[model samples]
Target: MIFTGSLNAQGFEGWFNKYLLPSLTRASVLIMDNAPIHRKSAISQLVEHTEHQIVFLPKYSPDLNDIEHDFSALKRKRMYASSDTSLDDIIRDYCIT
Candidate 1:
């Protein structure tokens, strides 16, 4: 289940307690994207004790996160063909490139 709000530690805490735990009866390993917040002490503690398995994908691999592709594509679409001369200009270029 995709947790739509902020992907921060607190958000994950709620997600874990609300959505993830209730489905524990199923039989399958949990495959998760490599996100620092997901590896927090609170979450790790809970996951470690549960029978539900978890796998963190390789670090620095954007291929593992589809959201990365979507965001990158959004950036590409927001940029312009003209070269940027300033940092803000570059940022704006990404807004409409």
Candidate 2:
């Protein structure tokens, strides 16, 4: 989902319930960075109620999180995009491939 503003706990919770939770076909370990939204009790409660688990990465360890690399690459690729290029197209071409 492309969100225009910062993601708050409520937004994350909604996305978790609507998308992430349903996508888990089996019990899985979800590794997350130490973002404040990820620490919300409601999100934790939801995850705990399911077979999936959430593991927070150690503080200040971006290298340990794979998505950071993807974000970096996305930013780099976005720099080269023409003014008319859409974010969805950039992501599809540079990230999703």
Candidate 3:
């Protein structure tokens, strides 16, 4: 996994080169939401040079995104783990680790 202090275009580009590109076994279709960072021109150029193709999801369709479901399950588990803890506290605990 790639870790970074931010989630902007630069951070994503770094992750793509350092982690995603090297992990690929074959040309793949990458499905992504239409976030501005994913739409960056430099990111498109980078993808064009790689063996992967990106396909953006339709707008406002979280139900169609598998990662969204994973996050929802994780949120539920975290909430259950510390029902009495404040959200900020739980988030801080996670971020610090």
Candidate 4:
């Protein structure tokens, strides 16, 4: 979640190194957006250590990321076009996903 400021680089690194890496015996390729944090050296190291490759999606092209559509669908179907007035509301919306 990038809501704090920037994306969670170290957290992403941990997820990759500790969990996503060991998730599969073979190398896996990760497709991602071209966020500055995603291109940082630490994340690069994590990708290398995990034997997974990050294939960044083109800038300004959320259509290329499959999750974008899913998120839109979730917002449309569950949120009922309501503004996320609180953390609870946001969490409840995501639960419907």
Q: By lDDT, who's the top model here? A: 2
Highest-scoring model, TM-score: 2
Report, for every candidate in turn, its global Cα lDDT versus the true structure.
Answer: 0.68, 0.84, 0.75, 0.67
| Cα lDDT tens digits for candidate 4, 1-97 | 2335444766667666777667778877877777665765666666775566877666887888888887786666555644546646665867775
Model 4 TM-score is: 0.43
For residue 19, what is the lDDT in candidate 3?
85
Name the regions of candidate 4 deviating beyond 4 angstroms.
Answer: 1-7, 35-37, 61-97
- Report the poorest 10 consecutive residues by lDDT, candidate 2: 34-43
Which runs of model 2 end up more than 4 angstroms from their true locations?
A: 61-97
The TM-score measured for candidate 2 stands at 0.54
lDDT of 3 by residue, 1-97 (tens): 6365769877777887778878999998888777777764666677888879877777887898888886786587586875688777766765576
Please list the residue runs of candidate 3 whose C-alpha ends up more than 4 Å from where it truly belongs after superposition: 2-5, 61-97
Q: List the residue pairs that clash in candidate 4.
A: none
Error of 4 at 77 (Å): 27
Model 1, position 15: C-alpha lDDT score: 82
TM-score of each: 0.47, 0.54, 0.50, 0.43
- Summarize candidate 2's per-residue lDDT along 1-97 as a digit string, tens digits: 6779889878888898899899989999988887888864676788988999888777886798899999999998889889899989999897558
